[model samples]
Target: MASTTAFIDVPESPDRIWQLIGGFGSLPDWLPYIPESELSEGGRVRRLTNQDGGVIVERLQAFDHTARSYSYAIEQAPFPVTGYLSTLSVHPVPGQTAAARVEWSGSFTPVGVSDADAEELFHGIYTDGLAALLKTAQGWRG
Candidate 1:
C-alpha cells in the first residue's frame, strides 16, 4: 500500500507534452534511467537498464490513453521488491498560463527479507524522471 508522487510544471500544452511522454517507446531518448523500453499492452515488458548497469524487467499491467495513464508491475526487477506498479497522469494547471501538471506515482511490495523500500526508491525514480522529461520537453516548446 506504499505510494509516492511528483509534479512537474511544463510551459506547454498538456497534449503537446503528452505527445512526447505518451509515445511509450521513447523513454531512453530522454530519461537516463531507462536505457531502453519496449512498450505493449498486457504482456509487453519494460526493460530498463539502470545507470549502474542493472537490468529490471517490468510487465505492462494497463495503459489507458483516454485516462492518460499507464501501470506496470515488477515481473523480474533487480530491486528487492515485488508487486510494483508505476503510473503517470497529465492535467492542465488552473490559473497557470500555458502550464501543465505532470503527476507520477508508484508503489511496490518488498521481496523476501528486504524492508519494503519500493515506495522510497520510486519517490526519486518518478520525481527525477519527470524533471528530466519536463526539462527536455520545455526546451522544445520555446
Candidate 2:
C-alpha cells in the first residue's frame, strides 16, 4: 500500500478545530473542493459532490470524538486508487493552548498508476484541503 500524510498548524484551539471538522460529513464545511455532502446509512456514509459535480461516496470506518479524529474509506470515487482509507485528526500543540495541528493521512493501492503518483495526488489534496481548512477556521467565529 502507498500512503501520504499532510498537516498544518492553525491558530485555533484543538477543540475549536475539532468542532469545525470532527463530523463524518463535515468536509464541505471546511474543504472548498467538496461543496455538498449528504449523509446516509444512519450517518455512517457520506456522499460528497465536488466543485466539478463529481460524486464521491465514502463510509466511516472509525471515529474518536474525544481524540478529535476520524477515519473513512472511499466506496466510490474518480481517484486512481482502491482500498483508500484516510484519517483526519486535530491535535493540541504543546505549550500553545490557542493553536492546533491538523493532520490528514491516507493509504491506498494504486490503480493504473505508480505509488509515487498516487502519493503525490493525495498529498496535494490533503495539503490543499488543510490550507482551505485553515482559511475557514481563521474566519470562523464561535
Best by lDDT: 2
Question: lDDT per residue, candidate 1, 40-98, as tens digits?
Answer: 55337767777777877777677777766677677776666667778777778899767
Model 1 bad stretches (over 4 Å): 39-43, 112-117
Candidate-wise lDDT, in order: 0.73, 0.95
* Model 2 collision count: 0
lDDT of 2 by residue, 1-142 (tens): 9999999999989998999999988888889999999999999999999999999999999999999999999999999999999999999988887999999999999999999999999999999999999899878755
The prediction achieving the highest TM-score against the true structure is 2
Say what the RMSD of model 1 is. Answer: 2.6
Candidate 2: which stretches are off by over 4 Å? none
- 60, model 1: CA deviation in Å? 1.8
